[model samples]
Target chain A: MTPASSAKAPFQNKLLPLMLLLPQLLITLVFFYWPSVQAVQQSLYIEDPFGLSSEFAGLANFTALFKDARYVDAFLRSLFFSAAVAGISLSLSLLLAVCADRVVRGATAYKTLLLLPYAIAPALAGITWMFVVHPSIGIVGRAFIAMGIEWNYLLNGNQAMGLVIFAAAWKQISYNFIFFLAGLQSIPQSLMEAAAIDGAGPAKRFRDIVFPLLSPTAFFLLVVNIVYAFFETFGVIHAVTSGGPSKSTEILVYKVYSDGVVGLDIGGSAAQSVILMVIVIALTFVQFRYVERKVHY
Target chain B: MRSFIAALSLGTVLSVSALAAPVEIQWWHAMTGANNDRVNQIVEAFNASQADYKVVATFKSTDYTELMNQTIAAYRAGTAPHITQIFEVGTATMMSAKGAVKPVFELMAEAGEKFDPKSFLPAITGYYSTADGKMLSMPFNSSTAIFYYNKDVFAKAGLDPEKAPKTWPEAFDAAKKIRASGHPCGLTTAWVTWTQMENFSAWHNIPYGTKSNGFGGFDTEFKFNNPTVIKHFETLNDLQKDGTFKYGGRTTQPEGLFVSGECAMIATSSGFLGNLMRNAKFNFATAMLPYYPDVAGAPQNSIIGGATLWVMGGKKADEYKGVAKFFTHLSKLDVQVTNHQQTGFLPVTIAAYEETKKSGFYEKNPGRETPILQLQNKAPTENSMGVRFGNLPKIRDLIMDEVEAAFAGKISVKQAMDNAVANGNEELRRFERTAKN
Candidate 1:
């Protein structure tokens, strides 16, 4: 939260900067803050789906939300989902970035190929993975069955969770890789060579010099990936499992849409959205508060 | 000089017609594939028959639950189409939204359009009508649960291909035999809650709820966790133990398994006939949905599926007239018969059924009469009319979840039924609160 140290020679006129930042400020207020305020206000009322009429319920919506065990289950499921997505995507992307950073031949092609999945839509990514592992016709699913192993995601909750996690992380790996690769390449070459000259092995140098310098980018990516898993993975879940087979894959965000929009429970859906907004805000706050302290930058 | 003179006259005629364009009525529907083409064809027919009004059909159907949700959203935004098709599961939601919809009975009466409530087959219209007998929506495409058995598979399994199972126990026995014959799948069902729970209760002449399955009021409770339903689930769960039955997920997902010549038998929407005719490689025939022969007054009429065209509120008066006229045109015997014969949707009217029968359509197309026969096998009792519950989509998910848990051996069939009732009742309670004031 500290102001950038490099801004010592900042602009003298506050009015110029304020004018420059006005558009973004307005956009955030209208797009983010307005709907957020409405969600909070709507959550306080018992309302029908069509927004035709409403009654003041005064926290009844929140009470009803927590009284249902499924909402709590969805919360825990979301936590596990977000943590796994961020962890797996981060480590895999870091490994790939390191390998690509060391590439001397056609580095651009390697990087381009690695980044291809990032551009694909999340729903399309879910569908592509779905067909590849579909129990009946999918290639991977057929192999599982051929090997005498059970492989139906539509019936099995654990398999459905695993498939969605892999698909969601698979799409996110490339986004993380670009940042990790940039972090690696930005490290001065002299720092690594100096460590080697001091009898440090490559692994030792990476552990000592490269990782610490890359911590800032890694920290930022972790926060972004968690947010991505929380709010933006609705398309993937919708096209794939649809919170199916007994609400096994019902994450908190998907529940909001399923409840409010599909199920026509407007008050409950709004209440869920309010809770999600609080969780995300608290999550980002924690990431900046604690995680930022360790970043070398 | 002759070509220029002819072109000038053509331009003048086109300009004159363009100045007097018809008033457009927007219709949003979810019909897809072959059904989508049929919907457009019907709209074109309506438009061709009128000079002042043109019905424009837009395929705005989203996911199963989304169409109702989208209609509500559009209503709030004041951009709802003049008419939108809603699934039967959402009939309760639409019925309670008095401010959001214009009832078909009122629309027809106000527009002076010739609409007869008695003209529609009661089994289909009963699902969309009020307790005092007012039709809420136009019954466009209606379907009921029907059983399909692969004749080739039945013969291969050493069963009499001509004699399909007429009871639940017999159907299960036949399914197991198909599995014993090394078929990949034996039996499967689509829309499990619809086929097994809603229609199953109706077909058994059992009360699925207290207030005539919510048709009486919005405060109906769930009563499906009885011994009868539990026994049915037990049979299904046992079938899954040896792969005699495959849980084909939800809503037409089983259609692929059945049509791919894999599954021997399936209980799915009669609307699936179109798909079976197109994609089924094996010989298959339709039968009345199997019922428990032990239950007294069993084999009651099956409830309808498919969707109805609802007129949204807030359109101009002239557009309302167009929607009314369109509904009248759509309910014509010929149009209804074409829809029934082509798409396998049940003809909504008694006239259409009699006409189709009189034309020897059933003789030409064997097995096409199974759905109608099942729907009219007996006088529909209170329980057999239809079931409605608010937030039925959510309740269906809960039921599917528990049913899956039972099928996956995470719980007993008794426990699954218990949880389904408990959870489903909770949704009904939430809806009760929403519906009252």
Candidate 2:
């Protein structure tokens, strides 16, 4: 290790990290955390859905939420969606990251091309897929019809679920790939050089040195991706299927929206939001407290 | 400190003078495209016709659903518009808000504007009228469901284009023949719940729900899962499976499919006539929605499906007066006739309809009078009064979800309707509990 570089690394960690993270932390508190607390408060009460004349009803809302089978079914569906999205996104992103790391030329262009889908908003992503998969209008549906294979997603529950998962995974893979690329680039090249000199193969280098160093980034991406699946991808669900074909795409956040915005049941909507927050916070806390320790970096 | 006092007094003087200026009534609505253009034209005409009041109309969003959401949010913030156009579905919600709304009768009386509820059409006006026959909100654009068919498709199918289907069996046969003629879309319906369940029951003289579809009280639960509704949903599901009927998703927007020449026949709001008249390239015809053959008085009256203008609270006396004056201007027979003729919405007033009739407008147009005739056929039954349930939007989504399940083959028609009824009852109970205190 270079003594001078080692000396500077501690200085960057001491006060610099906090300074760099301050703006983001403040923004998260204001925009995300505050509204979340309000959502919890609103949920534990009887109020107009439009946020007026709210009176406390204690745990009645929570009790009702538990009693409704729709809530339970929707919660389970959200778990499936989030888990499927996180697992698929991580696997695909790690594969892309590994492939890109092996390449010696045009890596910059490859990284940009791979991360492009992440730049599209979730709403637009849903619309883009809807165009390509719509039974009557979409190209894929047309091709299936031409083959005399009746492939209307509107009537097929399995196909609808598959399309939603695929679309969500496609959007998230780009983001995970970007983060993995950064983590891969940060690993010391000297370690890899030494590994090659020690008669270690590419697979051994990746397994021994590279993967261990990337664990922290992988953990971080897992938490972020799961949270994204829970909250951010709701726009996709709303745009494409609108929890359609018999509530097959009805996730937690979509139910919250449907209850609050469309159903005009503010209290019920708030209850759903509070439950969603708990699920997200529990998963996030688990990732940070338990999963973070496994990372070698 | 002396200069600050002088400046404060000066500002107070200027503000007082501004308050003494002509009243401006701000209206927020969800009219867009051609309807938006019509709204602007009407507001401009009203403003030009008056000098003491200025009416400012704003096109807030694309559809009534979104606009209502925003309006409710705005109302919560105490920054709501002087007038908000709430859709027919929102009527119960708006009315349930207690002191949030000002009855149109009171607004007119306070403003010294002449208002007579008897002048408006019985079917359209009764939707927003209070139990004692006072108008709660001014009916802006009223519409009822009607059957629309493609004449070209019917001719190609070797069916008589001159005669429209009068019974459900006939419609089913026509749909099959039309699909057999090579058109992918045979028969499709928009607002499947509203057209096929709610209005369908009303038109066929069948009970849609208990307590007169919630119009009698807030305690109504969904009972459309009964034999008639089950039979109807089963017929639709069968046709959907047989490739003769397409179930266009929620809301009355089948104009897209119809205009694109995809669907041969559709049942949607009479309000969509403007869009179809402007967009349809092929010949089209309109008829009263088909009824069941078993019911003795099957061809019952259809209910209205447009929006009404509710005067919100927390406004000044003069502003309310201005709102009332504007409402009076909007309710004039001539203005109602113009709005109906230009936008294809049903005239809110009997005089407006008679005036148009005497002017030979309906005679020249022919199908323009079908909605009025359908709405005026007989005394509206208990089912025809319209749905008015607290937390109706939730009940609506429950129905939509279960119905979509039925369409997707996940559940049978009977099962879906049963689920919808159970879920809707749960929501109603929840809403009833909330409304109690």
Candidate 3:
């Protein structure tokens, strides 16, 4: 074939792949990107959907939110919640994945048990925890009572926060573990063998070879886990404490949900959504720019 | 080939006939537990009573607010059901949907259905009607706040269960006794904003706002931070400090606590009576909510708490007729009495109340008449009538947020209430600019 025909042949080869990707691209734009843009636009307008009336409020909703101290408190609480979830889930999961990677047998069994929580729906996970920790009916509460611990979520803000945080971490560990397991298995075992032969200790082998290989995976999972912590566990929070006994467990996403869905302040809710998106986007951008680069891979 | 053609034609004819069944009126509601069983019974009775209509009831899950949101989204997409049970606070939101909703009064009038708005309890139907008494929606399970106490627990605490507290001071005494008796929870409340603030404003005959709490116009301002409210919250704060009162989160039924024997006393909607009466193994007694004895016009009246059935527009004319017929059937006295008996909602009509009384049901069930007496003890003032402000749902949220803040000791009750009032006024103004004529 001539040079021009050869170049044209490559283009022809890629045509099928491009066509195959079109449907997913369309779906993403329609379901995700389009709604995201609309949510931003909606933040700028007060809508009475029942009356079909819309008014341009020009950042008034955001202004009002800034003035509302509860919003600020919730935003700050969310930061702590997201960080804790990311720190706890990522660290525990990495350790679990590493230990399982060393196991010669029952790896699959251990993994199946560890990942079982991920299979359970987040809502169900929340309810299960609620039953286990309910002050009157929950097993944990019963145990606490028996031990003479005056443990009541309805009165103890610290205990309420601890319970919600534990529930969130419990539900998220499975997700992180699964990802970490896949990442651990994908690592080249030869590198570790080479490190071991060089008289490097287990810690040195992990530091030089295993950890470096896992960094890229860890980085990706960090972003996913943070986003999940910020948004996905609102269901759990809602089912468990409902942002109570004193709004101790109230996160930004739960506030947005209550304001939008329960309060029926669509514009206010949209403003909260916009704020949440900005936060997550900023965190994600920073991660991509800084953390991703730090990964040796 | 000849036999195959014959079979195809026969199947087509049968399918066409099967598709010709009565148009099913789908009702989506948030009733569960014993209430769910009651709803099923009602739907079965209604369906069995008529040959031309089939009323199918579907439990759409908990969270009435979420249910309303879903219904609104579905309505926008032109896929809402024929009827939906919206909580009382949603009345204004539904009313604002001019073309999206069909007034039940007009439907009943046009269909020549025998109905009188006066037949129902004024306190219940009045909330769901227009200014001139045109019924906009059908009242299904309306309830007002009542005080419930565990008699056995009260006796254990050395308080007379037969003579329940009639004022806040008395209530505090009882709560202290119960707490001193070593119970973890002495007293708790549900729907704090609704029960303690909105209904409190009415029950004490205090003005909740100017413009009759937005019934007259969209320029209504909140008066939640009034002196009575301040005093009440101060009392609650003191109780909290003393470990005698627990704010059981917004909309968390304290009735469950009473039934579980965790709490000795609870103030909750009378609608929860069915749940407690059926589930509570302990002896319980219901009483009217305690008030401040010193306040002028104290103990005026309590407002409604249950949901109403709003008829949405953009339906087939036949469907509108079907919905109207269903409303008429639902309004019958016998049906209303059955509804009241099963759900513990106050009978929406006076005739139903009379019917319920004449049948000796209230005699058999002592607490059955508490809600009626609470509603009919005094005529409602402008504030005693239910709140109808635009963005009131948002206001309720703000109030609850502040209340929770107060409970957390994050802010003084006065400061929280003041903040809520200001923030709620801003929301009201925004709503006014958008929807007000």
TM-score for each predicted model, relative to the true structure: 0.93, 0.91, 0.89
For residues B295-408, write the lDDT of model 3, one tens digit per residue: 999999988888988877888877777777888778777787788777767888888788888889988988878878998878777778788877666677667767777777
Taking the tens digit of each residue's C-alpha lDDT, what string does model 2 give over B1-437?
99999999999999988776678898999887767888898888888997778989988987787888888888778888999898888887777666777888888988889988888778866778765577788888888899999999999999999999998999999999988888888898887777887788888877777887877777877778888889888888888886798876777545577878888889998877778887899999999999988987888888888899988877899899889888878877778888888887888899999999999999788688999999998877677767677766667778888888888877788999898888888877766655553
Query: Which docking band does candidate 3 fall into?
Result: acceptable
Point out the higher-scoring one by TM-score: 2 or 3. 2
**lDDT, candidate 1, A87-149, per-residue tens:** 999999999999999999999999999999999999999999998998877899999999998
In candidate 1, which residue pairs clash?
A246-B401
Which portions of model 1 miss their true places by more than 4 Å? A1-26, A287-294, B1-22
Give a tens-digit lDDT track for model 1, residues B1-437: 99999999999999989887888998889888778889999999998997989988888765646677777878888899899999888899888888689999999999999988999888987889998889999898888999999999999999999999999989999998999999988999999999999999999999998899999898788899988999998988888878898988877777888888878899998878877887888888999999899999888899999889999988889889888889889888888889887776888899999999999999998878899999998888889889888998888888898988888788888998888888889888888877786
Candidate 2 residue runs with Cα over 4 Å from true position: A1-34, A49-55, A102-109, A197-201, A290-292, B1-19, B252-255, B363-366
For candidate 3, give the lDDT of residue B150. 88
Higher-DockQ candidate among 1 and 3? 1
Better of 2 and 3 by lDDT: 2
lDDT of 2 by residue, A137-255 (tens): 78987888899887776657677777888889999999899899889989999999999999999889889998888888888888898899899988788777778767888888888
Sort by lDDT, top down from the best:
1, 2, 3
